[model samples]
Target: MDIRFLVTFMEVAQTRHFGKAAENLYLTQSAVSARIKQLEEYFNAALFVRNRNSLQLTAAGEKLLPFASSLADTLEQARATMNEESIQYLSIASTSNAWDMYLKHKLDEVKGHLDHVSIRAEICSHEQLSRMVHEHSIDLALTTLPFKSDDVEILELSDSMLSLYCSVGIIEEALEHFNISIDWGQKTNEALEKIYPEIKKASMRTGSLQVALNYLSTHNSAIILPAQIAKELVNAGKLHEVDSLSPLTVKCYLIYLKQSKDARLKKFIEVFKGMIENQQGR
Candidate 1:
């Protein structure tokens, strides 16, 4: 069977429209139709049933779709594995601050293990990271909070705390520090809800911790951030911890699909586990 035909069939099956599939594949609509027809001829099965304005996969098509997708995915994974690139390509998803803080450090330790591994970082919510991992779009994920899942293994890397901070210059001059608040995440928001109910309305809201830091740096206000992030700025005299909520301890977790036996992944987990262990021992 032609892989190209299978590819075309899968595309059309997904979109359920020849024109849309062709657009996705960068081919002409007529060409896509021809390919689908050829595939049907080869398979001797009607893959799609078309009404006046709707498309539905026939029983044969329904059965074939999963196999075709798995084959394509296997091919892609095979390429990813056998490529002689210096760095093994690794896709990672995490919140911005976690990426900024630990990923670089971990990458430095793991670089020697691969010829070269390309690192792709996406700053997303924990749930989004889990979804991406499940879709096989990401190889691993780093998160500062725990997620509920049995399929994904959560490796605890470090115990951390969140604190409020800002540039030293800004903090020094601010009078009504009462207007300060955090960029409210479910974890931090709930923490704040319980710990400091007085600070209900956020002075600013940001999607990422980095943005909250930037906002705090530029304005005479306060932002609650991970203690590790706050630690750096505070040590540099660029920020200080607000007394209202001094610290909030949380675990930083490295999450990945529980497929325990990929060599590359195993090597990475070993390296990172050692690195973190050594860091803690010191």
Candidate 2:
């Protein structure tokens, strides 16, 4: 039961590509294959369904993923605990879109409240964020997707509104040509469809809010973005809201382990909540 094998397994599961996983782990592709084979032999199950130009996790692999992630997280935490300098380290995980929309600025404000703690924030997918929290790899997570885990405590943060926006001089043709679609979530998608039923296609579709912003800045593009951001850009005369349409709202949630004993983690959560409250009050 080598921990390295579990690490390898998790990497392969994430990438679903032996060469990609090996490159990330700095191992040869053959070495990655060997580790996966050994892990499969140990479990007496095939972890992956390999096909031409495709790879997917088998049922056993799906079952092992969470446990392997948890085990790897535990090992990492133990190592960090053994290192005296890492005692004050605090890790937070969130999607890049979430970070751009609110968490980035809020984190800056919170950092002032945490005098001695070292912060490590990562941008990852919602699924990855949940896995990290469950595995204890991250102390806290700010996400739109809530996790259904007894070991985790979820707090409703706030509703983020998304409104359609475009540059002032863009015509309908240009707007359609440079339209950017952002994946807020399933609920937002449904709302968007109801609001803009005729917009069957867009020039670009992305999950990254930052990318959407960049495209809007460089092109005469129209996009649905966080209301706060849209307002700021509008004030700057860079963007204007599509007043003909209504805004869509999405709820954001903060998650942390219920069993966490770290004082810094608790304090950061308090600071974050207070900041949100103060913002809403204004």
Best candidate per TM-score, number?
A: 2
Tell me the alpha-carbon RMSD of every candidate: 9.3, 10.5
How does each model score on lDDT?
0.70, 0.78
Q: Where is the poorest 10-residue window by lDDT in model 2?
A: 170-179
Can you write out model 1's per-residue Cα lDDT over 1-282, one digit (the tens) per residue?
656667888999889898898767655566578778877898899999999898999999999899899888888887877674545767778866567667655666666655556766678876788666654557778876666866678888876666655456566744345345644457767877676565566676555666666666667665566666677777887777765354666556788767445787777777778878888889
Residue-wise C-alpha lDDT for candidate 2, range 221-256, written one tens digit per residue: 777777766777889988877744444576678899
Cα misplacement distance, residue 232 of candidate 2 (Å): 2.9
TM-score for all predictions? 0.66, 0.66
Off-target runs (Cα >4 Å) in candidate 1 are 1-87, 113-116, 166-175, 178-180, 183-188, 244-247
Off by over 4 Å in 2: 1-87, 148-150, 171-178, 244-247, 261-264
